[model samples]
Every structure is written in structure tokens, then in C-alpha cells.
Target: MPDALETMKTLIEEINKHNYAYYTLDQPSLTDAEYDALYDKLVQLEAETGTVLPYSPTQRVGGELLKGFEPHRHLARLWSLDKAQNHDDLMAWHTRAQKLVNDYNTQHPDDPLPPLSFVVELKFDGLTLNLTYDRGELVQAATRGNGVVGEGILANVKTIRSVPLRIPYTDGIIEVQGEGIMNLSVLVAYNATAAEPLKNARNAAAGALRNLNPKVTAERKLNAYFYNIGYADSLQFQNHQEMVEFLRDNQFKISPFVKFVDSIDAVEEELEKLVAMRNTLDFLIDGLVVKITDMRTREVLGYTDKFPRWAVAYKFEAEEAVTTLLDVSWNVGRTGKVTPLARVEAVDIGGVTVQNCTLNNMDDIERKNLKFGLGSLVYIRRSNDVIPEILGKVTEEADGSEIVPPAVCPSCGHDLEKKGPHLFCTNKVGCRPQLVGRIAHFASRDAMDIETFSEKTAEQLYDSLDVRDPSDLYYLTFDDLIKLERFGTKKAENLIAAFEKSKQPDLASFLYALGIPNTGKTTTKELAEHYRSLEKLMQAEPEELITLPDIGGIVAESIVGFFRDPAMQRSIERLLAAGIQPVSEEAPAIVDESSPFFGKTVVLTGTLTIMGRDEAAKKLEKLGAKVTGSVSKKTDIVIAGENAGSKLTKAQELGIRIIDNEEELQQLLGDV
Candidate 1:
């Protein structure tokens, strides 16, 4: 069949040139198992030459499931801009765009209009889209609807892998626009293994491009940028840096954040450095467009019946609101899970006030319709200092009321189970808020550092020395800390010298002070460097703890259910009968490479008071670093402590390298 239609037209132009070099040149010269073996040999030579090319890269995997959306109509008009919100609404939209460029340079002084400059960009948040193309292929996408007709969604914007299926500006028909989004670190890694998580990344990229199922918009792996060519049939430019270098020479995916600037005090100093670099952006802008770099002074400052008087946006100070829900509570944690917590009604939002939010379980309050969101009104948001979530109800008229869920353990009466979409409680050794949150996380400061232990001194040694568990604080003394209740005498010799300096520690800080549930000090330092002891990580074997590299299967079933719990083996035999030993973990530390966090990675974040971020993550894993926990873009040093929050604003939005000096972190843990 003519060499199988020239091997399906050379595997449809080499999988659309490796999906435009992995989504517009992130530069992957093939390897996702060699671009899925040339996209499974062009889907088995288009199912054995039945021939499918309509620019087939297997027609970008989305076809059978539409039945609805069709409208289209946009060859032009998409508009919607005008917003501003402050600095006297951006100096009254920069004094009405400098009096429409001084009345079109006082009635066209010989075809004038040159010096107005402007551009800016950012505004993003997500969903507008548009698309079209025609001669260079794409042919239709839509969604800005009322801006002259929309709907179409060419198979959910061809599952948006940076949206350009073919384009070198093939002579005519254009359109363009953009926005799409959903990349707050890919919605925190798709809500860390989502099972109904999404809760707002601009409504998860506008409900995954208004789904009619392009396989749920290709499982929301969406992304886009483009920046308006809004209808081009035989393109024309005259500015916005020659239309962003012709949408970067038509390979599209543009947003490298163009600036331009001329005045309006350099666009309010680039909108206060884009609201202080939109807290280290992984995408969600919501402010700063500005516009106007010419195009004949944006055609003499045009349009108003719904925006675009030469672009504006600015916005930014809402981080969501609405409020009122007013009640939900639930609580109970130290792993006996239970969660919910809504409360609401106080309000304010992006300037704090909030008053409690997080409704995270009961399948996230029945997937955020907030199972009858308490007295309704709802919505919430406030991402920065996290704890402020809710996101539902605002009159679907469920007329609020159900939230129920608690037949037991509101603090110890036991019984609550559920497990998937969570609830838990199986009172691991009689609760009292899970033994005062496991002895304030086993004397925290990265565990077992003990020093004046607190959670109100583990509820006054669990009410005057009955001290339930963390091996009964090593059978207390100095007459059980000189008879508790605010013990003095140098706080009973500093809580009996921090329980003899946490008796020998080390095996990954005694397996992260045994609060193991899905272990963390980097998976208990890779399970004490792959089971060095505590009897070979209590004789592991979740198929060798999922072959070590940070043991999975729910941390190898929470380390084989915390060492086959005979009540956690009688609290590890009364903390090894009160002596505690630990020690083991040794190998893996040859790295020096002129130190200063040698092979980087790091992370840490907030509260490090001169040491103990588990002793600065064991002196940053003996100076070779790696640390980890969250903040992505494969972190590369973060540290910052003492109230650092949101992983120090996601390491200043992934530009990384933070430190925030504790004497430059003890001169880079120099003599740890």
C-alpha cells in the first residue's frame, strides 16, 4: 500500500515532530519510551492502512464521545478585558489610556501614533482558549462563547498538549487566543493521586475544558499559552513585539511573559513585580495584562460593550470568598483520621480573617457540594497559608443541612471506621487524642528531641503521670518530673535532660520518632538507608519494601503495620526497656564535592531555630543534601524557617535556592 502510505506519512510527521518537541520545545528528542514507539507505529499503521490522516498523530487521541457541542462562529471578536481593581483602579486605567493617546495624536498629525508602548501580559488564571488554524491544520476549538459564538471544543482542545497540532502559519485562516492552564505544579501532582480532588486550578482549567469527555479532557493534563492572534487570515502585526515574534514563529505555546513597558510608571512597576512574582508561579496568575503596544494604538483605543478598551485586567486581591457555611467540625487526628472541619462565617480572605475551612474527608464533603454546605453561601479558597478550602455551594439551593458523620471518637469514645475517603479511629491503644497526638509527635523538633516536650507537656504527663505511651516518656522521674503541674526546679532538670538526649537516636532519628503512618523524614531516611536495623526494619518485605527507593504500597503498609502491632510491639518493648539505643544507619555518604549542600535538592521550610529540622535533616544528609517533602520543579535548596509557609511560597515559585539565613544556615551546616 505504497509502503503503507509511506509508513503512515512518516508516522504522521514524526508524531507531530515529537509533539512539537515535547509540548513546544521543552526539548525532548524522543523518550517516553521513544515517544511510545513512534506512537505505537502510528497506531499500527492506522489500524493497517485504513488510513486516518486528518493530520493524524493518531488524531490526538480523542474522538468517540461528543454528542453535544457544535456552534463555532469566531473568525474574530473575543474581547473581554477591562478590570483594574486598585491603585485607584490603575490610575483610572492609566487616565483612560493617556486620553486615547492624546486624542489620536491630536487628529492624526500626518498619520502619527507611535510612542504609546505597553504590552505586560500575565493575567492567566485559565480557560478562554479559541484556536481555529485552518490552513496550518488545527481547525477549530472554541469556548469564549458570548464573544461572537463558541462551544465547538474541537475534541476538548485536542487534549491540549500545548495545543499546536500543525502550524507554521500556513498562509491563511488563524484565530489563536489561549489561556487553558491547570499547572499549579500540575495541580499539585494531580492532587497527589487524586480520587476526586481537583478543587480549583481555575476550576480545574474550567472543568477540564468544559468536558463532554475528551477522555475527561485527556485526564486534565492541559496546558496552553498562545497570546492572541485572534483571527488572522493573512496576518498583520505592527507591534506587541511583532505579535510575540509571530507567536514565536508559529510553533505557538508563547508565555515567556513579554514585558515592553513605557509608563503608567512602568505599568505600576510591572504590577508590583507581578504581585511579587505571583508567589513563585506554577501558573494561576489572575492579574496583570495591561496591553496596547501599538497595533495602531490598539485601533484607536477600541471597544466597550463588554471590555477591551485596549486591555486592562490588573485584578488580584481576592483569593476567593463568598463565606457563611458556618458549621461542620469533626476533627480527631493522630492518624485515627476523621477530619472535616468547616466552621466558616468570618470571611475576609485575601487579607486573612477566614475562620477555619478544610472540609477534606467524607469524600471531601461529598465532592465539595459540601453535602449540604451547612447554612450555604460557601466558596472559600485562600491558598497561601493553606488551611482555607471549602470551594462549593453558592446557591444550587441544596438549602443546606446534612454534614452529619460522627458515631463516636470525637476525642476518644472510639468506633469510627470508613477508610476510603477517610474516617478511621480504631483507637490505637485508647485515644485521648491519640495519646496527646502521640506525645506531641514524640517530643517533636523532628521527634524524640524531647526537651520540655509540650502539647501542654503532653497534657500534664497525660493527667499527672499516667503518661500513656511514647513508652511512658521513658518511665519518668526526678519524682516523675517533680510532680508535674508546671514543674520547676529548672523544669525538673530540663525534662530530665531531654530524656537523656533522646537516648542515642540516629536510625533515621529512630524511624522519624515512630509516628510512621506513611513515614516522612524522607521516608525515614529511605527507611534508615534501606533497613540498616531495628532488626532490619522489623524484617521488612512488601516485596522487599517495594524494592527500597522510598518504599511504597502505602509506605509498605505503614511499615508492615507498624511492626505487627502488639500495640506497636509493646511500644517497641517499652522503648527497649527505657534505654532506647537506635544508632544503625551508616553507609551512603561519600559525597563531599566541596560541600555547601553538594548534590543539592533540599527543601526544609519554616521553623528551624538554629538546628533540629531533624538536626537540619541530619546536617543535610551529611552535606550531600536531597531532603525533599514537597515544593517541586525538582527543588534545589530551600531551607527557610521560622514561619516560612507554603514551602516558602513554593521556593519563590520554583526559581528555588532560598536559605533564609539562620546565619546562612549555620554557615551551610559547616560543623554539624
Candidate 2:
């Protein structure tokens, strides 16, 4: 009989050759039965020898199920790319790259750098996998967890047919990063047999890779396409495109749509083509990743604490789908606007289930000729994967009933007032939905932060105890809540205690909790900063309001109009009378005028080590700095943390000063 080691070596070579032919070349050299027989013989030989090489084909059978995933420190950090939503954002990024190259050339003088180029590839909507190969042998595989550390998933990764157990080159360590994706067709087929159907291909891939059972991952048949070389000791490439070419040459799958572009206009043209081709792809793709081509330029540009400064992801437009319009329900918002919500037959769009979508106003409904009935099909679009909106009607049926505006408010049965495109309830005090929404917003974590206070509790209080408004929550006794279902003496006491504890919120939190139209968290913070007190804000005119940063004419008008309302004034008076005294603590005096961040417009991005982003922003604001979200020409400085994306790139392009670590940030803020 042949020696076990020789037999094992023969089996490994044969099986690896077969895998390469079948998976890499899409051609099978052996029948299924023959492959299985060889695989079984290899497993038997490994057991008989009592020795298993790291790259042995039999190891693909997987080991005993793990109790839990073991944490692993990655060979190299995996940073996330910053994203761009529109063509303008992409153009801004391109402009920044050009400027960086020009700056480098100017600094060197003698050895001027070449003009910048970019490589664009499809941004696969799937889980990231980092594969490490030591001396041509697959050693470890991990998922991208917080960039620095990850969970080891070597067993699951080996099950992927396209991933070679051993490569041709026997050299130093090489770490290749790719996205693990399941084809949409394969996902659908798998879901049919699966006990719990997966919602989307991306989720399915993620679930399979993370599963404790390697057999499950193998059964799913997950595939991968390598995009980057995270670490390689011996390998060298001039640019990202060259690295991709090398990966492709090594029998690794790569994105077919990869393109090398010279200008921003060319990139935009390619993006348009991608949008048209995106739906036809076998896998899901949210966007395209654009990277600087030259490795030397990338080194010069460097990285923020969290993301590389050289690349940005340009996201595709929102997806639209057609579904049966089952019914229309008019709901009242905190602003008393009665908006129609279309209850549709559940349909999958971009892997998300869409059942209910918003119809902006009565005018929007009329414009779209949206009829109420079961037969009519409505078009729904998820804008930026956040807002679900009814685009228009796909199919109109004459038998379908026409949707008409309600003469009376649905929640309060009061007369509805027609104001331009919207239908208003105007019953601010009595409207149940409005009251419930407002109360819920007030007790939310971002607001007064009344722990355990929920919308259900707010509804129960409204129906049972006549707790009509936010101020009425303070008046609730234990007896009042005890009468409601699921409410006992202890629960009622706890709720009342929570309400009492929520009597004093910060000025910004209180302002946001009021549910003022067009006033988001950022706007509220800006308003609080500019006015310092509610009394001062209420006294400010629209002209004065428009002068603050990010406060436009429309937003300014909305703020002024909200404060001017008689009912809002009464609500504020009642809240104060009920002992809700919001306070604005005085900001600390600036230590020195020499501080770089003093009175500057700064933007903070990514995960900071010293403190939370919010805490840092608050501290910066206290030091007379205005912190904004986006990076623009107006931006004076950008304080970046780990994984900071497009904003950092844009800041670099605009020649804005960037502070990386918390220590550097503190130095600029005069906190050191």
C-alpha cells in the first residue's frame, strides 16, 4: 500500500486541481461521485496518519461546531470608505484628489508627481471577509469587526469553493480582502428550503458566514470577489488597478465592471452606466467605490484614523417597486398635518419589505391620481433607504374608488383646514395622534429621556386618564396609571418617578422634543446656541433666525412660525407651570485666542477614543466653535477619528486643517 503522507499529498493536489477547474474555470474535470470518493479517501487517509496539514483538502469538511465565535486581531486594519450621494459629491472628491497631487508636486519641486487617476468598481452589498495566506497556504479568515479586531471564520471560509486552500506561490504572508456575496437567484432557491426565509441576499450571506455550523455555510454556496490587498510582504503593485490585475492573474474572482477613469466627467458617465446595469446584476450592489489609482499618491494622501483619505463610495439612487395599493390611511403628525399613508401588499425592493409608504399630501395624491382600492397597483420608492414614498400609480383601475380628502380630522373629528397642499387638523389640544406623537417624542431618549415611557403608555394615559399633553404627564398619579391594562402599583410608581426625573432636560433636547416642523436635532442645537434661552429664541424674528449657520429661509420661517403659534405658547406655559424648567449652563471661558479651533467651523467624524462624538462636539461648541456635519469650502478644520470617510477626503482637498487623534484635537481646542 502507498504511504499515508504520499497518498494525502496526491489527494490534496488532485482535489485542489479539480476545485480550480470547477470553481475558478467553471469547468468540471471529474464527476460528482468521483470527487466525493476522492474526498472520502482523503479524509480516511488523514485520520489513519493522525496528521492534518493546514491546507489539506479534508479540512474543508469542517470541525466540531463551535460554542461561540473566537475573537481575532487582524493582520491589517480594514477601514470603511466614506460615501458620496450625488454627482456633485463625487466631483468634489475628484477636485480634492487633483489638488492633493498638485500640492505634492509643488512641495517636491524637482520631482513633480503625475496627474491623478481613479479606479471605479461596483460596491457589493455584502459582508466583508479578510483572508490571510501564509507561504501560499490559507491560514486565517475573519470578518471586519470595528476595523482593528474581527471574529475568526476560517472554517466557514474554507467551505467557499472559489477560495483556494493553497495557492501557487510559496512566499510571505498575503492578506486579501473581499466581499462574500450570495447571488439573488441562489438566495431565493435556498430560502425555499430554509426553515426561516432570508430577507435579502446580503443578510443571507452574513448569516451563513457567521453561523457556528460550517456545513450550513457550505450548503449556502457563498461566493467571493477579492478587491484589495490588505497586506502582502513580497507582492508589490504600483496602483490599485495593478493590484486588481495581480489578484485576477492569481485565479481570484474580481468585479467585471472595474474601470480606470481619467476625469470626474468620465467617472460620472460610468456611474450612469452602472445605474442602468445595477438591476441586471446577479448580486446586490448599493453603489460604486472610487479609489485613487496611484499607490504613491495614496501614501501621500494617507488615511484618517478610521478611513483611507484616497477613496469614496458613490451610492446609487433609491430603488422603486410596484405593489397592490390595499388601502389608504390618513394619519396626523405632531404638526397637525393629516398625511395619507398607503397600506400596500407587501413587496420586496432592494431586499427590504415595503408594506406602508407615505403620500406627501392631498396635492401629491391628486397629482399621482392615486385611487383607493385593492385592484390598483402603486409605485413605491425608498428614498436613500430611509423614507418610503409613493412615486405614482403603475396600473389604474376604473373600478377602484377615488381617494378624497377627509372633511373632518381622523383622530379628533374636528373640522379639517385646507392650507396649500396639506390638510391640517388644527385641533392641537384634542387630536389623539398628535398628542401621542408629541408625548412620545418628549419622553424619547433624544429628548427628556424618560426611561421606560413609551407610545403605548402615552396612548393608555390619553384613553384612560385624560392625560392630553406632555405637561399632563407630570400630573399623573400612581392611581391614574394603575387603572390601565398591564399597569400595577409598582409599574405606576416607577412611571411617575421617571416622569418626575425628566423635569429638567438640556435646552437643545427640550427644543427638539417640542416636535417643531423642519427643526431636527442639529437645527435645535444651532437654535439653542444662537439664542441661549427659549425666551430669547421666542423673541427672535425670522430675519435674525436666518443669520445662523444652516438656518435657511424656509427653516427660519418654520421656526418663527412654530414659536408664534398661540397653542404652542400655551403648551410651553403649561410645561413651565408643571415645573419643567429647562436650563442652559454657561459655557466655559476660552483659554486663549491662539487656539486653532476657537470660533472656527469644525466637523467631527468617525469613532473617537477619548470621548463620544456628541461629547466632543458639545465641548467644542462650549469653546465657541461651530461644529457642522458636511465638509465644505467654508469648513476651517475637520477633527477625524477612526473610519472617518468622505468628509475627511473633502477636507483634505479643500486644504482644510485636519486633526487625527484626540490628543491633537485637545491641543487645537486648548484643552491640553
Backbone clashes for every candidate come to: 3, 3
lDDT tens readout by residue for model 1, 268-365? 88788878878687777767788878887777766545776678888776588897887887878777888878887786643235678787788878
**Candidate 2 structure quality by residue, lDDT tens digits, 93-201:** 6765676677678879898766777888999988899998899888899999868788899999998887887887677899899999998889889888989887778
Question: Positional deviation of 519 in candidate 2, in angstroms?
Answer: 11
For residue 79, model 1's alpha carbon misses the true position, in angstroms, by 32
Candidate 1 has an lDDT of: 0.77
Judge candidate 2 against the unseen true structure and give its global Cα lDDT, from 0 to 1: 0.82
Q: Which stretches of candidate 2 lie above 4 Å from their native place?
A: 61-63, 70-75, 84-88, 134-136, 146-150, 168-172, 188-199, 233-236, 249-251, 261-280, 304-307, 327-343, 346-375, 383-388, 392-591, 594-672
The Cα RMSD of model 1 versus the native structure comes to 21.1
- Pairing residues by index, what is the TM-score of model 2? 0.60
Write down the RMSD of all candidates, one decimal each. Answer: 21.1, 10.4
